[model samples]
Target: MLVNPHICPAETTVILHICPVEMLVNPPTALAEMSVSPLICPVKTSVSRLIALAEMSVTRHIWPVETLATRWSTVTPVQQRRSSTLAPVQQRRRSTLAPVQQRRRSTLAPVQQRHRSTFSPVQQRRRSALAPVHQRPCSTLAPVQQRC
Candidate 1:
């Protein structure tokens, strides 16, 4: 089975089939119902605090320090207006293609390469009018720019 590089694939597939033991226990309320370990309580609490600190540190590194929310302020109206304008342009570009069109465009070149010899199948397909060479996806354009 193929695994996604960005996530822990083992944890993901296990989640699909069964609830994890930790999830079966409701952490906050269930502590009242069961006899808890004294040593474990401090360890668990510190682990959670460490996780939160680590997450915050990563975010601080990734975004500007001055941008972190302070108690006094809300987002400025000018920033909101600028973001709203850009969002629609991005969404329109994303939403224009139906899944079939998206899939056809994604898979076309890979299919061409698997079928033929050293002669470029893309040029051949263009000549045959199977796909307008002009309609080639943006990924194809990336390599030409990279080479230059």
Candidate 2:
């Protein structure tokens, strides 16, 4: 992740898919029901909380946070929105194509890269005549200023 305060990834700030340990300790109100965890993460930048949960065994009910929601879901993913001076929606950007080391792809992150129009395959080069060079930043631009 870019770790930029002004550019928090919206995906992480939203509800994380995790079930409560209560599911393991007691029978469900409905058989095979999975309970959703309360809001552990709020909508804000620079606020990251690492959470821990018990492993699921004896049943295939529990798995990684990401998988649990997809496999079994009784509650909709909570989506909360609040105004933040930082991390504006238009300013927020995400990219999964980076790891933390040499010849490193960190710069390839969307944090500094500008919006690119359709062009030839990325297999060629990131910069081309149609896409041109990305010299401007990612802030909202006026129509006249948006050329490139």
Best-fitting candidate, scored by TM-score: 1
> Each candidate: what lDDT?
0.68, 0.41
Q: Candidate 2: give the clashing pairs.
A: none
Off by over 4 Å in 2: 1-57, 64-75, 79-148
Question: Candidate 1, overall lDDT?
Answer: 0.68
Q: What are the per-residue Cα lDDT tens digits for candidate 2 across 78-147?
A: 4122223323653543222223342265666553354343333563565554363355565565767767
- For each candidate in turn, the TM-score is 0.24, 0.14
Candidate 2, after superposition: displacement of residue 118 in Å?
Answer: 44
Q: Write the per-residue lDDT of candidate 1 for residues 38-114, one digit (tens) a residue.
A: 66788899999999999999988867633543222465776566667877888887787567687898899787877
Inter-residue clash pairs, candidate 1? none
| Candidate 1 residue-wise lDDT at 48 | 100
